[model samples]
Target: MITLDFDGFKSEIETPSEDLRIYNFWATWCAPCIHEMPYFESVVKDTKGTNLVFVSLDDDRRPERVKAFVEKKGFSSPIWLLSEKEQKDWKQKLKEDWSGAIPATLFVTAAGKRHFHTGQISEEKLKELIETYK
Candidate 1:
């Protein structure tokens, strides 16, 4: 797991690649985010050739808590703590429709296709989204 500030995250999202990428925005305190994590984990285990990145929206002052939570949950996917303070600015950069909501997701493929979803995502729906790129 790695910690990335706003610039690093932007750079990551901008760099295009042939592989499919899924950026899941979550936090330790977000119940919906925690609840849907298992579903994401299950999909990650079964799927191949896809990049699953868990971007934690926890407070910058308490990154240890975020780290502890991820370790406690046994999350296998690469996790990153968002270190940026200007949430509004970065949120717009990620997506104009995004309302800085937790449990949000961004799916990008090598073909330049991008999909953004807000709120808790079900396993079936996640699979369906992934299937689109497959």
Candidate 2:
């Protein structure tokens, strides 16, 4: 898994691209986040021309926990750990109306349109969103 500070995260999300990118913000300790992961993974496996990034909000000091969790889950998508301790400002930068919630998702389409969802998304909804954006 790669670790990124706020600036790096910003650059990643801001850079122009032609493929749809799905960024899922989560943590090892978030139950809802964990619950929604399998659906995300399933979508990642089944979807084409779409990129999914699992962005860990776990503490940077204890990335080992996140790493271990990922290893146990056998996640195939790229995982990222946020290095910033405070998310107040950066969370807003990610999405203005974001409430800093777990299981949040930010979708950026090939055409550069962006959509942000603040809660757990059902598997069907995930697929629908991908189809809508892709």
Candidate 3:
């Protein structure tokens, strides 16, 4: 299991040569995002060697909530609260038409191959994803 704050994401992800990156972008206030977090963490802990990250889309205005939820859920993966600038850049980078939605996930390879999921995810699908790349 890994713990990632926002400050730690880019560097951690960029340092890997070819690891698959499973990034879940979420917010503290979004009900579905909050609901699905523990399941994401559970899969990460159960799997042995896959990379997982949780990027919190909330700003400083909601840090407490984010922190509280992270602790409450006992998340063991990396968690980050994103920068507004970085968030905007990512929205443009991932999809110009994206409305900055929370609970979006991107599965990508180090060389930039990408697969996107725009809503909540199930544990079985996550486990399958981790296995397929292993």
Best by lDDT: 2
Compose the digit string of candidate 1's lDDT tens values, residues 31-120: 999999988988967888678889988887787898898889898888888875766688987898778988999998877678889999
**Cα-based lDDT for every prediction:** 0.85, 0.89, 0.72
What would the TM-score be for candidate 3 when compared with the true structure? 0.76
Q: Is candidate 2 or candidate 3 better by TM-score?
A: 2
Q: Which residue pairs in model 1 clash with each other?
A: none
Q: Over the stretch 36-118, how does candidate 3's per-residue lDDT look in tens digits? A: 88888777776665577888787755567778878887787777666654665657656556777778887776665667778
Give the Å shift of residue 78 in candidate 1: 0.8
Q: What is the lDDT of candidate 1?
A: 0.85
Candidate 1 is scored at a TM of 0.92
- TM-scores of the candidates in the order shown: 0.92, 0.94, 0.76
Of the pair 1 and 2, which is ahead by TM-score?
A: 2
What's the C-alpha lDDT at position 12 in model 3?
Answer: 57
Write model 2 residue lDDT over 25-93, tens digit each, in one string. Answer: 999989999999988988867888888899999888988899899999988889999986757678887
